[model samples]
Target: MIDVLIVDDDKLVRKGLMSAMPWDSFGMRVIGEAANGEKALEFLKENHVDLLMTDVAMPVMSGIELIRIVRKRYPDMAIAVLTLHQDFEYIQEALRLGAVDYIAKVQLEKERFEEVLGRIHGLILNQRRKPPNEPASVDQDVYPLDTAYAVLGLGDHPLVNGPRQHSQGWRVEADGHILLWTPDLREELWTEVNSDREWLPPLPDQALDADWRLVRLRHIAGLTQFDLLQMVRNYRQRDFFYDCNGYETNPIEKSVQELQADQPEPSEREIEAVKEILHAFRWVHDSQSFEELCSQLRKLRLPASKLMQLLYGFIVDWSRLFKALAKTGITLPDTFLCWSEVVAWMGGFREVAATLSGHLQLSREVTVSIMSAVKIAHDELEFPLFAVDVAKRVNLSRSYFNQCFKAIVGYSFNEYLRRVRIDKAREYLAQTAKPIVWIAEHTGYADEKYFSRIFREQTGLLPSEYRNRHRQR
Candidate 1:
């Protein structure tokens, strides 16, 4: 796979790029990301990456400077720049400095971003086929791959900040993981590494040769720090993949007949498991419970495609369930459009479980009480309702209620009430011969003038004008 690194100061952009793209389908993956060029450079020092996608402007070190340095040190690596509309000059300079292409930040929609990434993937693959142009002398290199072995620290592990070496290889403690590298290149040595519980490798592509499982074997001839870092990044990413019996099963190679033939009707116990997870989600607020739910999900033995389908079905079911609970004119968030977007962001079933759990856990208080309070407000519009009255009905202090309401409903309590009142007013204006005053009073407005003012502010028309324009006749 073509491993990529994203460098940007904007977290939103980082997340968007991370979640929005079809990475695996394009034969690429985001091995790591950095907020600025300095961090990006540091990541590069530890990982072997095929491509670098960076923003034009950043805090620590600018992308142009990074590009110039990368071009000098890693001449074979492909580079891309993310530029703003006003950064045309910078883009030109980046291209001159050795960047392969540029993407306008403002226009980074899903289609365009994938298109650019796919192009870069093709370029990288092509470049890999060609031989490296670097001189074949160890003396020219700062840390030549042939002599001194590179050591990488695992993240937050007990062995971190320490170094050890056997006659066979060198090992360094990372934060929590231990990275080992050696020039031995023996098949048995790698097999032993693979057998270790602490080692997590990429999902094996069974379609390829079995020897392919040891990724280091293919790259050891010209191994750089990037290669070592890339291996660690690849290992970490396996956590995001859906595991079946503790291994990755490639779904793309399976035939349609095999997929359809293996599908079995879900058992009652499996159905109940789904229900129990959803039930727990409504009350689960802490990360511990959320993670527990994710852990339980890994035990499921369904195929990856089937598992994804089941998760999407659950999201749809939950959306309808949530809407029904609200019992009012509440519109669900726009996130309902594609469940695959959620799955794509997560890469596998466990991640899907965690994300769904987190989403369901939002604003537990708002969901339980405001749902009932919404029904009260909608059904009791003619009785005069206020934010405090709704809060009182829900047994919440007005300030806390307003906060939860806004957090869960995307609108303040007052805003929701006004919206409801105006919507009902419009319906009556279109369907009945009632006077504007009667309509206002029925929809909870005490004064006809005040209703007219708010109605115009919301719908851009006076009540009579709206009726004349939209009434059946």
Candidate 2:
């Protein structure tokens, strides 16, 4: 039987709740109770209850604080917040602290209470199957990925834009609706679509009778369930909201075969570096003052760009860690993603650390990405590093690197280099009217016609138009 604990300060309320739910029918056994957060902590110290349902406002410690402490220490405990509707502050805090359900007293009839209990039971069962310290051998129980459908317009979205990192969701066309899908949001949609029973299966290959149907998507990223959970949670705002534009169905599964196919998966060096970075925030006392910790990063032998990638990766991981906390009845502020904007927000590390957070934003993980453009730009318009060689150095497939480089830097390597060379040639042209052939050679363009074509495409005017426009401006 699943063990349980109900914590509240009121004696009558505690007894009433114990008698209200038929614990046996829901596969639960009430094991204990606590009148305050201190008492709850004591109970947790002694017992291994599968779940802990508690009142938010209590003596000695608030329910949110209790949840926070539990999330930090006993991350395994599931939590539910029992508070009045008037406790709006507590409700938000409770959700951040990992409260699985928030039920008001006035609406707590036996029928509704039973339903809440069942969902709590389902959620708890899900939590028991996950633990942070375990290794790969213990990872097979990852949550099953579900199919989800969503509709996002090309406008501001809370779920996508997040405070720090912008979302890279793709817009796909189906039924004439422009759809945007982020793997993170897709995971939430998948869980919701699976948990909600309103769905009725459609006839196979009948073009989907309804506006939506359940989809089974594969978690082809090759992340374990925990990693997948972290990926979604990291991108989401604690108080994040999204628009319901339209919907489409998606099915997902764990990408075990894809991972195996990676032929020597992720390197141990990369994995070790990421691990160190995640644990870094713990060492730094504050994130608000990052310059104070710049030396610390240098000590880790991490460059600034590499450190940034690690920070981004950890932001995603911390978000996932919060999910486990939510399952255990601990919720963090939805403003959690604000940690990512630290560098831009704070002028330097010293200023931020003096305030608090002491550069604790992402706990400082090491992820290195080469900043070749910035390096190559100053030397000449045509970089000595060929496009293929640059791609090989970054350890990306030729095609994949081409796509990633363009996405991150906003231009293809050769394309951008050509543009720069052409622009330089334009300078020489307007300044002294150099020969087109000389300009082409300087820009690394084998064909003068090709150089002119690319220059016109980029500037929306031919090389001549560009020279004339610059003179006019």
Candidate 3:
């Protein structure tokens, strides 16, 4: 059997890997577990292990250092990393250091255990059958093409005039933009070109003001002319998705299969929790609560698709609530490619939320009317309560009642009622193992499929999947 050693800082994670996985089924055995890279090295010195599955971040020696050492000491042993979505940079580094593959820590759910282990098993087997001197099946230096080149962009500045040639690279002007192709793959080369003030011409009385943009694929030796041009076009198209200051390392290039594989369906409960926190932020303006929201978001480790969905929901809801207060356009990109982009976008959103919250001014009468209407919707979930009926009950005209409800609740009366029923259905699904049809009927959804469709739209999960996720939690 293939012997495996698992290393992570968390005792719970180590224990989970040791006990929860069916190692024998994959023709592997968990021979040992370690809390950190240092401990892992110590264990390796005394034990025989064929596979090392390690986490990238730890207290003592990091996984990167451990991999570097282990690669030299035991070149034949297979290495894999346990990584979160945000650890892509570290993952790239590990892969470059000869890691065969990586397993997402979030994919350790019981249902996905076999699929993950099987993939790892296959990779290790492939490595064992390959000749040591042979290069990897696919060339890392050039990706999706044969030739290697690099793309560089220099902004309008006094130091750079039009397209200029360097000894290391060729430069040309395209569409009023400078495009440079270089075969140099060294980090220092890109760093100096992008940021080294010494490489730039000194101004007489001011600091250098220039924007240097570099685009390179990870593990690529260089980019081809076609690849460079394609990447440059992609960079321009996705300008809004990236931060303005930093050079783009990996452009937004992903296959549909890769995106679908990366996106994990978020539960209704998860979405609701975020909404609750955001709603609280809108009214109370509590810094602690907002910080907690950020903390929770980080902890969730949501993939870009799910994160974008959650943020889109928030923006749409907020836009409805603050329609009159909205002085500027609020929008979201079609998708986000990385966690850092999401964080940057969220920072801007925090400002928008604060600005809109400050502009909110609700009178006692409006507040009471809205609250009463909300209470009625909650109390009469099974009944078909129309907005007009609730409006009359709250002693307001239909139009006035709709305006107040949307302003206060961040959803239209119909939308709010639908959400209330779905939320009620979610409670039933989580708290008890009730039949889905029964739950649907009680939540005012006569058809189970209709209820599931609505639930999926709101939560990104089906009723059953949402229930299963809650149980796993």
TM-score of each: 0.32, 0.32, 0.40
Give the clashing residue pairs of candidate 3, or none.
148-223, 149-222, 149-223, 149-224
Clash count, one per candidate: 20, 48, 4
Estimate the overall C-alpha local distance difference test score of candidate 1: 0.57
Winning candidate number (TM-score): 3
lDDT of prediction 3: 0.64
- Residue-level lDDT tens digits of model 1 in 2-61: 788999999888888888888887788899999998999899999998889999889889
- Poorest 10 consecutive residues by lDDT, candidate 2: 236-245
lDDT of each structure? Answer: 0.57, 0.50, 0.64
Q: When superposed on Cα atoms, how far off is each prediction in RMSD?
A: 18.1, 24.6, 15.1
Per-residue lDDT value at 152 in model 1? 22
lDDT of 3 at 116: 62
lDDT of 3 by residue, 1-473 (tens): 99999999998999988998888898899989999999999999999999999999888999999999999999888998887652344366787788866777865677557656765676676667678788854324443322222333332222244323344454432232334444344435555534432232211111124434433323232433333333343333223223333445443233322212333445778867877775543332445655687766765555334566678777775554444434467689775544455666767766664565445564545555675677677778887789989999978999988887787667899998888888788889999989999998898888889989999999999999999999999
Ten consecutive residues with minimal summed lDDT in candidate 3?
A: 199-208
lDDT tens digits by residue: candidate 2, 1-473:
88888888998888999988878878898989889989988988889987888888788998888889988897667777787652333365566456655656644665456555755775565556656665632222333444323332221212221121123333222111122233343344556646664543232222223232222223423333333222222112110111111233332122333222211223557556545644443323334424444333333433223444655665554333222212323222222122233333323322332232222222222111223332344245543557777666645556765665564345677765665676677777688677777777776676889878887877677777777777887
**Candidate 3 displacement at residue 182 in angstroms:** 20
Candidates sorted by lDDT, best first = 3, 1, 2
What lDDT, from 0 to 1, does candidate 2 have? 0.50
